[model samples]
Target: MKRALPILAVLVVLLAAIAVANPFFLEPAGFLAFLKRAAPLVILAAGQYFVIVSGEFDLSVGSLVTAEVVIAARLIDGDESATWPVIALLIVIGLLVGLVNGVVTTKLRVPSFIVTLGMLLILSGAVFLWTGGAPRGALSEGFRVFGRGGLGPVPWSVLILLAVGAAAIWLMRADFGKTLMATGDNERAAALSGVRVDRAKIFAFMLSGLAAAVAAILLGGFAGVSAQVGQGLEFSAITAVVLGGVVLGGGRGSVLAAMAGAFTLEALFTLLNLYGISGALEFTVQGVIIIAAVAAGAIRLPWKFTPRKGDAHAAS
Candidate 1:
């Protein structure tokens, strides 16, 4: 929790700023609406945190989300009865894609960067081919409820976000989290300590995939179906994780911090919109953030040097 303080502080400040800019933001209905919009991204960031903390990246999640949404719309086709079944299928597809990415990276000795990038391209191409440039079909009202409906006063998306956030926190405190941290910090040492490094990493990728699937479900309901629904989300998730102080190379950072980072990003965007900033600048902002955050982290790292044999002898 200590590691999460900075991002949490930033989040609070952003929320306060929003409240000032728009007094309606202080109302329960307004705040709940903000949370609903932020839920998918927060969930995505939580999933990305798993892979990043395990010293790997899953670039395919954005494409995976697109694929899931497109597939869900096509299969569900406004059939309320098919909602549950199609959702199940989408989850399976997510796991399968993650499994393939993980196996290729860990077991086949390919770099995760290459593996997930390849998967991203592959999924993108496949979606284009499947949808023929435009997605078809519509989500049922029942399917949309999770993203658009609320239980009396509370949005379902907020409830789902809380559930996912709690699960992520709990997971990080478990033995698996310890092993994952060790693996990311030093793979060889973790392996020597009897940790299943490869397995842990594979599971991390799968968790990311699961998160993408859940996000896709919510987005399909909230934003409706679009070929570009998941566009740029991978970068957003990475930026959010970095904003939370998670090192790009991993092994340090808290899940709470990561989720807080997502909220912070959302709030920043909202504030920018209120200030009449163009949304196109969002990508530019994210680019600057990625570079700055990585540089800041590098600066904070202690400098280390090992003396050469001659220098050691001279010192001795």
Candidate 2:
């Protein structure tokens, strides 16, 4: 909770600023709309948090999202009856991608960074090849409903975000979550203590993939289908996680903080837009934020790593 406070504060401040700049944001309708728009990224950040906290990366998720959308558009092809099956298939695809990444990295001894990067390329190339430079087919209204529709004043996307957030928090509080943290903090010690470190990592990758699938669903309906839909989302998710005070090279931070970081990021973009800043500067801002975050984490490492006398006793 402490780690998440800074980002939460930042988010609140940014929201206030946006409200001032555009009073419409103060309204329920406008606010929910904002949440709807930010939900996909927030969900992706939550998924990325699992992998990051467990000492890994999931660069393939961005491209995975793109692939999911492209695949969905093709499979469903505006056929209302095909929507659910395609959605299910997308989830499966996400899991498969994550599984391969985890297996290759953990079993084959390839670095996760390399594994996921390669995955990103493979997915991108596959999408390009399949689509032949332009994606065909249309999304059915039933498919778009998840991204564009709401129950009364509340959005379906926002509801999905809440569910995902709650699940992420709960999972982090469960046994698997504890083991994952331990694995990230000290893999050898965790393994010695009976934790299946590799398995946990594989699960993390799977969760990330699932998150990508959900995000794709929301994004496809909200932003429509395109090869560029998930472009650079991987970096954006990473940036959000680090900004939330999660350390890189893994083993620290809270899922709550990671989600807050996503909200803060969305708010920052809203602020920039209100101020008439060029959207092209978005990547530049993200680069600066990531570097600063990693540097900050490095500076704090010694304090975080130093063991208290009780730690040894507690382990024993």
Candidate 3:
């Protein structure tokens, strides 16, 4: 319950704002549209939650999403026949990128923050070099289905988000998730317990990459393709995750809440747009939220680790 309070509060606030901005927001379609728009970010947040709760970051995801969309367009080129294979290739690429990020951070002993940042730059530069300026080709209809298509009244993206959310929750309740939490709580102790610390972190990063790829597919369909479609998305996902109450250094959050955080973010943006708020200020809000969330997490450490006298610290 404690894990879900922040998300619940955010959700209630956002819903109230929506109701105030436009009475129609209470209608089914309004809510469905909101869910559809939020689907990608929610999925991405779940994926990012794995990495974050495991004690790392995956900055490459934003550019990876851009790259996935671009590569999809170039390879598909309106050829419906190419969609599945190209998607498979994109998944492989995402896995490879995640694998590389994981390896460098775990085996090479580099900070994941630095390694993923380097990856973000590398991916952005590569996309720029390959596309020149405008992206080539277009996404075929079949390929676009995941993003914009739905079954009668329900969007496929929403369904997919539900599936991923279920899976993420299941993973968090499994042995791997338990091991990951232990690792995050204390890597040395986890390693000593035969937790395969390196492997857990790698898997977390891989999940983030996989999330980025999935987000890219939906975004490509809804927002359309561009050289900059996913710019700043990493920060957005991270912010949503943090707002869900997941601590930055890991071992302290819930996937369900993280998904809720994504929804809250989308609703907030929609409310802002309804109120004629400039989109430009969105990033400023995210920056402040990220810092504040992290700092708030830090403030709890003393209480969480309160020790008996002469155990660890001398009370003032």
Candidate 4:
């Protein structure tokens, strides 16, 4: 809770600023709509939180999201009856990709950075080959409801976001979450203490994949079909996580902070758009945030004493 305060505070300030800039934002309808818009990225951040806290990275999620949307469109082809089935297939594809990433990284001893980057390229190439630079077909209205429609006054995406957020909080409080943190902090120590480091890391990757699948569903419905639907989301999620004060190399951070970071980011973008900022600069902004956050984390106070040789040895 203590670690999460800064990000949460930032979210509040952003929301307040939005309200000031756009008075409509203070209305219930406006706020709910904002949540709906931010849902996918927040969920992605949650998933990324798991992997980062477990001492790994998932660069493939953005590409995986693109693949899922493309596959859903081709398979469903606007057939209402196919909505559920295709959604299920998308989930399976996400898990399978995550599983393969996990297996290759852990079992084959490949660095996660390389493995996921490769997966990202592989998925991106597959999407291009399948679509030939242009996506075909359309999403069913039934499917679109999840992204654009709502239950009465509330959007379904908002509901889904709440559910995902709750689940992430719960998961991080469970035994698995503790073990995951331990593994990230020190893999060898975790293993010596009987933790299944490989399995934990693999599961974390799978969770990230699942998050990407869900994000694709919302995006497919909300934004319609596009070859670039999921472009640059990987960096966005990472930036969000870093903004939440999660160290890049992992081992520390709260899930709530991570989610708050996502919301803060979305709010920032919204504010920027309202102020007439170019959308093209989103990537530049994210890059700056990531670098700033990581650098802030690396800073040490001048008053902190340097460790003596024996002190370092004892600490280790």
lDDT of 4 by residue, 165-232 (tens): 99999998999899998888788989999999999999999999999999999999999888888999
Error of 4 at 40 (Å): 0.4
Instruction: Tell me each candidate's TM-score.
Output: 0.92, 0.93, 0.92, 0.93
Writing each residue's lDDT as its tens digit, candidate 2 over 176-208 gives 999999988888889999999999999999999
Off by over 4 Å in 1: 289-316
lDDT of 3 by residue, 286-312 (tens): 567557755775576467663422453
Question: Residue 101 error for model 1, in Å?
Answer: 1.1
Worst ten-residue run, lDDT, model 3? Answer: 306-315
- Model 3 TM-score relative to the real fold: 0.92
Worst 10 residues of 4 by lDDT: 300-309
lDDT of 4 at 157: 95
Worst 10-residue lDDT window for candidate 1 reads: 301-310
- Per residue, candidate 1 scores C-alpha lDDT tens digits across 152-245 of 9998999999999999999999999999988887789899999999999999999999999999999999999999999989988988988898
Which has the greatest lDDT?
2
Q: Is candidate 1 or candidate 2 better by lDDT?
A: 2
Output candidate 4 Cα RMSD.
2.7
* Every model: Cα RMSD to truth: 3.9, 2.7, 2.9, 2.7
